[model samples]
Target: MVNLKLKLSEKANYLAFLIVFVSLGLASQSILAEEVHEPAEQIAPHQEQFEAGKFVIEHVSDAFEWHILTYKQHHISIPLPIILYSNNSGLNIFWSSKFEHGHASYHNFRIEEEGEHAGKIVELNEAGAVVGLPIDLSITKTVAGIFISVFILIFIFLKVAKSATSSTGRAPTGIQNLLEPIILFIRDEVALPTLGKDKSERFLPYLLTLFFFILIENLVGLIPIFPFGANVTGNIGVTMVLALFTFVITTFSGNKHYWKEIYNPDVPWWLKYPLPLMPIVELTGVFTKPFVLMVRLFANMMAGHMIVTVFVSLIFIFGQIGGPALGGAVSPVSIAFSVFILLLDVLVSFIQAYVFTLLSALYFGMATSDHH
Candidate 1:
């Protein structure tokens, strides 16, 4: 019965993962096929527009401010610190609001409204044409989100640790109780199985950290308000860094046998001779493994966020085109779909964290495995 229960649990997890992936990917088709309508030749200077594509993209993209809501053309957002350095401006430190929600320029540096540099800080020449770029070390929305998520992870784990240490023999309680199963799951099911008992303990700490960090960030991004919804895990840059860490650890952990398998495996001489085809393929696999890790997490998390935003945007799009009545009619349906996706995203958050950690553990095991 215990074994049967475990099998069922594993099957359920996979089923949920497939559901989230397929549903989110299919729902995002509308967003991928969205048409960007160009502006008229002569348009009003202060004209308002509701571009669904921009709406969805802006929500997923990083920003200098934490936008709460926009009411009556008054943007309500928490401005993050803007730390910039440039040849012309030297070092300018100020609030992102000094740019006034990208409406004004500060110190001749402004967030580009359009063109190739859209959504980026650019330095302007005397003629107002873009001339240079600044080294931006600002605490943007995504950066802030990362900081928040890291803080939450540290706080929760520290408390859990303290609780476990204080009562050595007693049953786990509170946060420790909540998280103990997950920790054990990583150990018994993921690490121990893939990496074996010898090295699993050695790498368990990193695997736990990786799993929780990605999991927390993924869940936090689903929160649609204040300090939480920065889309940190959805960002390709963040995923790339996470994947690079796994790659670095795997490469350094590789023993002589691992490299030997890559360079000159126990295969046909023809495969490794002349053009060194097998070696080339094996070398390519080294790079592609991490690349796949990066793209998979980024694409999956990004699709979830984008699909939810697209559903919510539908209400506004209908409202604009057919006024309040049409929008009011669509609001319930749109929100229902958004809520459904948000729930799926929660499941995906766990699945992605598990998948990344599992793959990483497998790589580490292969790298450190002894030639028996």
Candidate 2:
């Protein structure tokens, strides 16, 4: 009986680990959030309705102003700097607050509410038509998040490095102690096997940096607060840049053997000569490899955030349609599922980091392989 009970307990613990994760927003998003609202009376009837989709999109998307929270139907946000340059305006430097939550214009500039340039700062003519766009080099919310994460990464490793060097023979302690195994895991299980001793030693630094950078960004994005959550990995631009780095590294690392495989791969003569299909496929793969890395990370992180927001939106959906009593009744169930997803997402964050690093190492291995 005791053995059976322990088995059941083990299963329960495993099941518990499978619980929730919210995509981009997680718990930080409010279903009924008053998102930079203009006055209700002036708004259109359809516009007054609750839009979970809009909220989710806004939650995951970058913004000129960092929205902290909403209270008493007021949006509390920190407006960022707006650096705009146009041939006409010369250089218009101002704060995002001047736009007044997309309600007003400042100087000769306005935040377009609809059409092509919606949510963008467009330069207006004297007669109030949008004539052109300024070169906006503002430090957006995502940019700020990247800066913060970079700072944290630097701070963490510097301390870990100090602790490691100072305690040479002694056992690791504190943060160094905690991260040692993880560091070794990447070096041993990931880099060493794929790249071998000589190459692994040389490339381990890049691999380690890649692993921790993605892992930290993924985890921090789930926090849902300032300097914590910026949806860094979910942003395609960020992922694309990261993938490009891997591509550039692999390209440069390629040996004579690697290039030979691409242009003059060993295959049946008919297959190569008929239409050059084999060579085309081989070359295409070189570009596709990094594309896969970029899309996979971006899609996984982006989907997770959006799905959770959808799950949480259920509560407000029911509340709006059936009144508060019914909404209250449904809250627990919706929240339970959201929590379940959020928990599962935590596991995914680590897996994605490991996978990205592992694949990168594998690519590096293939690029510099000594094999025929």
Candidate 3:
């Protein structure tokens, strides 16, 4: 009996130690998982919405259709989707097509065919044209906003410019008072420094217009709602068109001196002649310069937006399965980084606009300069 009692006591002690070891293992695992899982989950929300927004921008047609059949069906249409989040409901998805004006029950439609949902595979009629066009009233809203913004800026500036020339040498009043300093700065600092007093005045109108237009558009894109978030400057086509205008203006404004410099550059004899290849290479540089301008602005703007979106997405992906503890751990980090990027984006907005305008003015100055 004594031996049996001793054996039982030993067994109980062993079991207690085993429980402690198992509990320690699980506790460590939970800690590690929380650390690893938090950031990914925190970023998920930003990622999901950003990708969804980018997809919509890439696929959604801006072309307006007057009638249902007259709809220009270049690509398949998915019902207009929106991402909604609030403290009360968490996250919700809504389709604009599902809701009717003043009606309560939402009628949502899903894509029956693969192309329709994914925005691929256009259907063409016998005349080899698109069968139907997606109704794009959204674009009109965007256009209206752009027009209003442009009109306001232009009207205000034109008034300011006119005031600067008016009877009294004293500064203008009202909106003119607000904008006078910026205009003078552009003229004195940007233009005079780079293009000189004589040539700078000639290009001032275009430089100011470009700068203000881009600045407003970049700010508007940050709104992240309907009639906004159109990625105006980030759109390659828009940048290309703007670049083309600059190219045309520069080309037409080019004096005999500009052409002489390109065709007969003042270089070392070896480089100027270069057997036969130097002329060809030198000529190519002229075209390549404006092309670089188009690509640089578009790429920088698009890339910054994409990176911010990716970081924000980590929250959504990890949070879905992580529950509270893991999600909470990651949210702060993701939000912090997103805020950092947002601040950087603000600087980038101005920098990019300034660079584009500055380079354009530089080109114009060179084009119109008198021969040495």
Cα lDDT of model 3 by residue, 1-372, tens digit: 222222322332333233223322211110000011122323334423225455334422232111111122122222333333333334445543332211222222222223443432222344544444333223222243344445445555445545545625564577657655655566677878878877775667666667776776676665555445556677675577667767888999999888887887777778775464566676897798789989998898787667666666666545666855776788888789877887887889889888888888888888887887
lDDT by residue (tens digit), candidate 2, 272-359: 8968878899999999999999999999999888877887788888888998898899999988988888788889899999999999
Name the best candidate (by TM-score): 1
The per-model lDDT (C-alpha) reads 0.79, 0.76, 0.55
Task: Give the poorly placed runs of model 1, Cα more than 4 Å off.
Answer: 1-47
Clash count list over all predictions? 0, 12, 21
Residue 102's lDDT within candidate 3 is 12
- All models, RMSD in angstroms: 9.6, 10.1, 25.9
Provide the lowest-lDDT 10-residue window in model 1.
26-35
Question: Which ranking of candidates, highest TM-score first?
Answer: 1, 2, 3
**How many clashes show up in model 2?**
12
Best by lDDT: 1
* Candidate 1 CA-lDDT value: 0.79
Give residue 127's lDDT in candidate 1 (0 to 100): 83
Comparing 2 and 3 on lDDT, the stronger one: 2
